[model samples]
Target: MSTLKSRLDVVEQKISEAASNSGRSRDDITLVVVSKNNPAQMVLDLAEIGVSNFGENRDQEAKPKAAEVALAGKTVTWHFVGQLQSNKAKSALSYSSVLHSLDRPSLLDAVGKAVADRAEPLDVFIQLNLTDDQNRGGIQTQNVLGFAEQVLQTPNLRLLGLMGVAGLDVDPRVDFDRIRNSSEQLMRLAPDAKYISAGMSEDFEFAIASGATHVRIGTAITGKRPY
Candidate 1:
């Protein structure tokens, strides 16, 4: 087995243990292997290991990376998880099957315009900034419902759930609760949107206990991205 395969095995084992501790079935959680900044071969290595979902945080890098992965004849679900811009909407949407960074009215409008009349609507999550930094890519807590309503109004985009990352100084538990609470509020608005996406190598266990349906893991599973 490859060295990366060994790391992935360990990460999956840790996930199983976390699920057991949280009383949630391991199957209930989706592991989104984060491949941002990692080479395409590294990503294919993950695909070979049976990962169906991968997350990328940039448009320029992700677009070609995905194309290369496809050219190599491997298919995987790519998720756009970075701060999104209105200009890159089309290219970003092209590579991403699900997007975890839907945050503003303009972006909602841009995506609706970009994907309108496509065969499939894109799955999207409203990013809830667990920190005080507004520029950090999530809509503020007070604006989640309003933003979600915008998402619902936006054509060709399905509001899947909420996504968040803990702030540098914040506690993981608190950050995750805020994200889970956002999901609860969102469900009241749109019951079908029930996926809570959060956590990472450092705190996925806490996120699982707090009701995250999906966790984006990078270094722990793939090791550090080679610069």
Candidate 2:
């Protein structure tokens, strides 16, 4: 087996074990291979081996990469998993089927305008800032519900759930638990918005155990960034 496939197999095994230990099935989780800083050929290779979901954080990088993948005739779900700028909203929405960082009112307004008249609602997750820093990429913990309400009211935007990153030097599960609680709160407002988009390479297992429906993993499966 190729080294990439070998690494992928190991991560899949760990995911299965984590899900089973948490009383959930492997199918219950969606493994979004975070391909930021990696090449499009890597995404095509993983897709050839059955990886159907890929994530990118930057529109500039993702647009050309996504076009290359499509030109090669490979079909895959694209997820935008980084803090998005307002000006890039339309471009990001062009290829990304799911947006994991719908954090601010201006972004919501931007997305709402971009997707106006589209046939499908743009799938989105309200990112929750797990740290005390006000300038972080995600929504403040206290403002999540209020922001979620705004998301629901917007046109052509589907409120998926909450996404968060654990603070530095803290046990990951602590933040995962907080994400779960925030998801629960979001669900009360939009019951179908029960999905939690948490976890990365370091703490995905903890996130899965704490009810993460989507795990954005990089390096473990994609290896180190070239840059």
Q: lDDT of each structure?
A: 0.88, 0.92
Q: Against the hidden true structure, what lDDT does model 2 obtain?
A: 0.92
Residue 79 miss distance in model 2 (angstroms): 0.2
* Model 1 score (lDDT): 0.88
Write down the TM-score for model 2: 0.98
Candidate with the greatest lDDT versus the true structure: 2
Q: What are the runs in model 2 whose C-alpha is more than 4 Å off?
A: none
Candidate 2: tens digits of C-alpha lDDT, residues 52-108 = 999999999999999999999999999999999999999999999999999999999
Clashing pairs in 2: none
TM-score of 1: 0.96
Off by over 4 Å in 1: 225-227
In model 1, state the lDDT of residue 27.
99
